[model samples]
Target: MDKKVAIVFWSKTGNTKLMANALKESIELQNYQADMFKAYNFDINKAMEYPIIALGCPAMGAETLEESEFLPMYNSIKSVLKDKKVFLFGSYSWGDGKWMRDWAYDAKNNGIILFREPIIAKDKPTDDILLKIKKVGIDLLSD
Candidate 1:
């Protein structure tokens, strides 16, 4: 079977973008095709084309998902994402990563099959954070 992964994200200070790129590289290293897009540029209609979908967005004001673009796009594509191997990742500056937890909880409730635990970094990603993300990428498409 052809292995493909889609990475969609929104970044303000580029931290989340950095995470997205690292994930893409790692997945490619594993010889799987990985396509990436900024939240506004992603086409939700094509969501079903990939069995694995990774969504990234930094925690915004009040530690919520990026509202103007990311959240709306996520809301639209999430239904199609049910039964797909979904991964959630992002960067956060404050509030103890409540946003990611809440997001993951909601995804589980909505019947999305999460590939693994959500990854979160404070501000810019450290070497440790990047390494862990790379591992997640390497293992993402596997059982």
Candidate 2:
């Protein structure tokens, strides 16, 4: 059976969206079914349809998740995330990606299975970072 993956994210300045698109492209290249969604358009219930999920959101005020939409959506789905395979990625302007770390911790606390440590880029991603992001998508498709 073909595997399915979901790439969902919120991007204010378009940085995180760029990463999401890169991941979606890489996943498709691997022959998996991959869907990309902006946070507002994504329905939390749709996450259960995918074997793997990649979530992205830039660090917001004080190194926290974006409060307006992403955070609420995440909170709604987190409980059901137990034992689910998940990947986290996002861009950060400062503070050493503390937000991603915190988010990862919450995911773990809710029993989600993290494929790897969260991938982070500062502001816009560099070519090297984009390569790494693509690698992450490939890795998630691997057994």
Give lDDT per model, in order.
0.91, 0.88
What lDDT does candidate 1 reach at residue 44?
68
lDDT of 1 by residue, 27-137 (tens): 999888999988898766878788889999999999899999999889888888896889999999888999999899989988898899999999999989999999999
Winning candidate number (lDDT): 1
Which sections of candidate 1 miss by over 4 Å?
A: none
CA RMSD of all predictions: 0.9, 1.1
The sequence of per-residue lDDT tens digits that candidate 2 reaches over residues 25-111 is 898898888898877776658877777889999999999999989998888778666756799999988888999999999988888
Error of 1 at 37 (Å): 0.7
